[model samples]
Target: MPRFSIVVPVYQVQGYLRACLESVLDQSYGDFELIVVDDCSPDGSPAILDEFAARDERVVPVHLPANGGIGPARNHGVRLARGEYLLFLDSDDSYTPGTLRAIAERIDATGRPDVVLFDYARTHWYGAVKRNRDAEVFGAAGAEVFTVAERPELLDLFTVVWNKAYRLDFFREGGFAFPTGFYEDAVVVYQTLWTARTITLVDRVCVYYRQRRRGNALRTPSREHFEVFAQYERLFRFIEERPELARWRGFLYDHMADHYLFILRQRDRVPPSSRPEFHRRAARDLRAHRPSGHRLGAHIPRTSFTLLSRAPYALYALHRVAAVKRAGLRRRHRVWRRRLRKVLLALHGRLVLRRALDPRLAVYSAFSHRGVLGDPAAIHRKAQEIAPHIRSVWVVGKDHVDALPPGVEHVLPGSRAYRRVTARATYLINNVNWANDLVKREGAVHIHTHQGTPLKSMGADLLKYPGARRGFSVPKMLRRADRWDYSLVANPHSELVWDRAYPCGFVSVRSGSPRNDCLVRPEPGRRESVRQRLGVPDDSTLILYAPTHRDHRQGGYAPTCDLERLVAGLPGDHVLAVRLHPSLARHHERGLGLRDLAERGLVLDVTDEPEVADLLLASDALITDYSSLMFDYAHLDRPVVLHTYDWDTYLAARGTYFDVTERPPGHVTRDEDELARLFASGAWCDEESTRLRSAFRARFGGYDDGRAAERVVRTLMLGEDMAAVPVVPAPGAPSDVLTRS
Candidate 1:
């Protein structure tokens, strides 16, 4: 018998069937059998199945004579399954790579549990992937193996059959089968969970549940959704049959009501004409399932339950309409308020622009008003110290207000104060271009302290790669560049690139990076303090992995390096610090599983750490892929390993300034194996790596002499002449000891 049997019930999923089949067939663990059940599919799924079966003997195609539904099709596959474990997969969904191996390992490690539940991510058609919100439930199980009685919260997970692997003997002994209907899997999922002797969980994401934009049976409006009542009815009957499961009646009732109400509220699911009848059926079911002395859960509003149980459908309909209207009114009021605020701000800004510039006032922003970060923040701090008369005000987004340091004055991006400051401030500083609506006054000084040296094509250079351009307007970009009085360049290469990319009249000041000044002369004990906070040992080899954002995969985080594989392959003392690009950090945290890994002491997720320079100082070496942090990290003179896994793809999709592979700062490895080997063999920080890093540094590491911020402060804010500004120290000079004279 095979170790596992994957049953897939196919209907009209022709678009996704091939990927589903191949996901299973291409698994590293080859002991599983693929049972593709054709539920009278009208599409070309049968032909695809036949094609796969002809090539692979592991495929067992079962064609139904007539359409019985997904439940019956799965039952037929189970009857033929000879594997020790039975797994169900939806034809539209797919298993992630190494899913079966991970499951098999978890099963063995947990002593062959009767049921194994795993996490899944919702893969959208628009290239965005979000992990299940309740994924933490897997880790909250509190043990490797446990029963439902020990952790009933497992029932809180979505009622789905595909995210689990069931021992065939245990399933057959329990006589479990999916009920036929719209929610066929609900009864089966609850039954297996409630009855299983031993249940375990795999915290990793094993499945990519494709959320289709259309053609989804559940999302379609129809009376078939009433099958939910029948499914819950079966679930309650199962509880009735076994009096021992009577304690879970209240919880099950709550689940059924929540599910019913959710379906009723969704605009696309229950039609307006059928809502009254749907509510009537739901009320009847809620009354029928109410256990003796059972009270509704805290999350379920008591008033909602009372209305569903007692109020007439007409009354309930009136209540729902009123609730929706109130919500709509609230939304409209908020929109009106925002519009009025914008109008007022615009008027205030226009009035303020007529007055003389506030020579002592300076406005700072970074990352397009993301927060007070990068060069702008560094410059702001220095101005506060040396040019105390200059009042610094930072413009940040409302969501990122907390990113501001204590006692720092800030205004929201679109506020009246923000507009007034933009209009009146004599010195305006930003790492990125201000909003498109920004107007440059005659006498105002606009300093563009760029975020980093460009490794990829930027500005007008992006005109060649339309994908990289991503709706970039060259005319508007140059207009913003035209506002610049001075452009801060870290090195000669940056000055040349900035001149070509942004054709502006601004003088290119080779003033180095104010941000890297922290790297050159970090506060004493900062490195150790940061390491301690991150739980990294002083003796460990801290490898900071910071990959740049890919222009092709916008709003997505798809790193080519398998983080788990890389971390597992490394020595126990070696800790990996993962710092995601700011753009992808918030959206991809759950998908990356960084929190879980950090808790396990495997890797440090320093993505949210306000200062990137602090992370550089805390790490022993850096691992990057085309991120300009590699250039900044070179200032430390540390070993840098280039993980160029998708170099060719990135180069084609988003044109780079030069081929990094040809002249990398350190050893360049294209695969995780090669990357792991470099660290294991001590080649990551060897003589050749140092030699390459020295050459790369000489080219890109000039101008940052631990006093870039001081120089900028003296020149712009303090009104010091360029010649009078502190001269950059010579190469190999003691940067840490070079204090203000």
Candidate 2:
């Protein structure tokens, strides 16, 4: 008998089915049968289901003649499952390799939890992920037997269903099914979690929830939020039915507040006049009080008086003025911003003629601006729009000699006296790590683009969480990144998140990197060409193991990869391309496991290489923990093995900004034995290989396309002819550390 039965609900999500099913079939822990119930989908989902059922005996596809939302379909599938443990997988999302294998072992070790809860993750724009780390242990209890009003964490059940695996006996005893028409998870989470006798939390991030952009499931939410009203009513009724939970009264207050936030968010769209009355009703009806605190206030205005009431065009204009002033956007070396804007306007007349000749014309947004002197991402991006034809600029100080763009003269070294750089060059840009200025208070056109990405609370939220001494100061960092004249941002939501975290400014929207953008595009055997260029063997699979360094004792985070087992377990043909994070790449530890592996000639360290992308492209897999580079590789369609040894502390320090169960690309492990077993057979099969490759590309896409450089050139430099501004020299700037004498 199969060890586990995966119950999948097939619905209208035919667009996302193939990859979803393949994820199940590819599990490194292969002892599982798939039970698929097609709830009469309107799309071509049925045809796909039929094809899958005929092709694989492990798959038992049930076709429901009529549509009965996700609940009934999952219920039908659960009934047909033959394994002792039941795993529910959404037809639109997927599972990582070794998910079931790990969970099954965990189930046995932890004494058969009614429900085994694991981390879940989701990707945005079908790209970057938002992760949540506090995935919990829940049990299988009747919906009417437990009340969520007491457990706020279970509220997350608001989003997903396939985030866990459960005991078939418990599920059978509880008689649980997705709620008929509304959210299935929401109806079950609280009841399930409350009934658990023993629940385990896997430190590893396991599932991948693919976010479908077009539909209004949650993005730009609507009246559907009100469904919670009925759901809560049922919860209240359930608790009343089961008098046992009267002791956890605190959950009641929390649920009331969660439900209140849900309702108030709904009323925000119904105009100000209707909102107050609606909120008043929420206060009187839901929580029995007036709404107060940071997010909402009837009397308080969102903007500052000096900027909001006095500035031109109010917010947008203030945003622009602040960007230019704070970031010092002009590329020309003129000390005065007014003079630089005038110079740029003079050059615009040239583009005006071209615009007249060709009506299809628009201004190009500058994607990068050196903002290291100040804000990390608030690098002034549209400097050309304000200083067209302006190029080469002077540094304010001396720290930035080698950081400037090629062909651009940085700063004359040994020049503490060059205070007034009125005639040197155009735009004195600051790279992200130069002279850090985080406050939005600085009136300069300094742009910022952060060096790395890991959203929740790593570097910026250092001080806020538990292990902050090793991280940077949050307020100071925000202020430094804030000093930029304008900002180059990834997405609007990112902007919103950043704005909420710091000060507001002009943001230049960007999709990806100006430098490493090549990773996202199909190399079309480019990896092979790159391998040849790098002088690596052609027949070997490559594994790039890179880890960041932190003060171990204080940091509480240590490398978790099983290097000896990994080296021993890897096929002789496979090469371990061990590249450590530059900061920690030094061979400081004399006899580290990885070092031993390298001594044995099983791996080679390439941490000092200028960029990791070329190596990543040529490689077959990556292994790391907490570094955001993994997200970038998600687009590469390669397998990844996570080695996060310090899982709890990392989450506590910086939150899991996204759901984890949905985003991990490969298996996550703690020691050498497990890692050895995984690579040995769990993931190397031909069918497993196809499943892994297909699931990866389905969510992340195939390539970077190499056009980003051209795009950047035309958009920010060459096409804009941004080469005529005079230099403004300052002493000791990183972007200006004495280039000229």
Top candidate on lDDT is: 1
In order, candidate lDDTs are 0.86, 0.53
RMSD of each: 5.2, 20.9
Distance (Å) between predicted and true CA of 14, model 1?
4.0
lDDT of 1 by residue, 103-167 (tens): 89788888999999988889899877887888778767387888999988888888899999999
Local error of candidate 1 at 269, Å? 4.3
* TM-score on alpha carbons, each prediction: 0.83, 0.44
Q: Which candidate is the best by TM-score?
A: 1
Report the number of backbone clashes for model 1.
0
